[model samples]
Target: MPISDDIKLGHAERLLAQLRESYLQDLPNHCGEIENLVLSFDRKDPETVFDEIFRHVHSIKGSAGTHGLHLISGICHHFEDHLKTLDGRFEKIDGRFINVCLAYIDCIRTAVSLFEKGGETLPLENELEQLRKRFLKNNLAGLLVSSSNYITMLCQQTMGDLPVKLTTVDDGFAALERLLQQKYDFIITDKELKQLNGVALTLAVRASDSVNRDTNIIMLTSKMSIDFPAGLAPDEILPKNTGLSHALVDAVGKIFNGK
Candidate 1:
């Protein structure tokens, strides 16, 4: 590499390191605020206090992601998911729930400490994710199969606000396995896929007597249309175009309404 280019790269790296150091310095203050909010449930209005707690955690997660602290970001992400499971029911906000929230706060503190020490943080991130899944166990389950991050983000933006717990996979065969082994309220897949395409997977589900045989399925395709074999068609086949987000919203709405 050119000497000038190498110098520029080193300068950028140094700037980034300084920025990360600054964020780490302030992280404890963020964690402490969340801990206080969680413990203030009895003294303050529960809804307002919980909202403040969520906002602090969310800010930390975003900042951590921007600084490339993915483990901290992921732990905070799972913590946010656990908070969502409450659905804003102040009545359900009890001592045990406060303890759980504090535990998440403590997890964030531990992750920050380990990060400073250059220790592994994956195990902590995974444990928090598992705890989140357990809390969401009773929520509506939905599976999405697509290799496109664009599609995944779009789906999350449109459908994520709902009370549904989404599981994502990029392969058709893997999606089929999940369908057979577990029940899902809905399935979304790209028409073109590896191992088995969406058409084949949809056919398998409809042909089976499994619990998800009658579940709603939404198929996304780049093409305008597809000719499905008779007696086997997904609940909705949407074209992946400018109107995809709207179509997805409408399709999901119809599914909820049993259309």
Candidate 2:
């Protein structure tokens, strides 16, 4: 007889608990190593030190996901992006940058401590939000996957007045790669992209186990009627028509307004 799903789930939960335990035990050392590396920055070989710090944070993010510490993984994702933005600017690695880097490391440490104490970490989450607002590109992140200039223009016009940092990709595969690595507030995709169509991309996003599994997806299609597969339809589908701009604006408004 086959093992029941409940039994399988029980086994998986136990294994995850063990992994989390191990991760919690080693998190301080990981954070300490990162902190020490940052504090001991050497201008003689900035590239080497930067790469080392990146690698450590990258490892911590991946491990956090494996151990079901999604919050830590999310924070690390943003921190990694923050680091990447400063990669080539060696001179920018000054007091402000150092302070931001230290704050990120401390955020991870606080998260771990709160988790161990079974305490509410919502305030820490808010602090991270405030930090992102000050140091990162935008408080909200968005991805736009479209090959149409008109669509791109409309999206840009709509998102210009908002506090969203939009990243554009012309292909679905590239969009998928971004989705897997980062968290986004919403995604706007074209239905007839060259490599991957919008429907197929939506299906992939919905089925993915990444941070963006439930992200809002607005699909733009030239066709008036599309038979989307069950359980794979995008949040909003707008046809290519005269009112597209208005519809797109409304869609973006609802998304930002949390409607």
Looking at model 2, how many pairs of residues clash?
0
Error of 2 at 112 (Å): 0.8
- The segments of candidate 2 whose C-alpha lies over 4 angstroms from its true place after superposition are 1-15, 42-44, 137-140, 144-186, 190-259
Q: Which pairs of residues clash in candidate 2, taking residues 3 or more apart in a chain or in different chains?
A: none
User: What does candidate 2 score on TM?
Assistant: 0.64
TM per candidate comes to 0.57, 0.64
Clashing residue pairs in candidate 1 (N, C-alpha, C atoms within 3 angstroms): none
Count of backbone clashes, every candidate in sequence: 0, 0
lDDT of 2 by residue, 29-65 (tens): 9999999888877544777789999999999988887
**Candidate 1 residue-wise lDDT at 29:** 91
Model 1: CA > 4 A from native: 1-3, 137-259
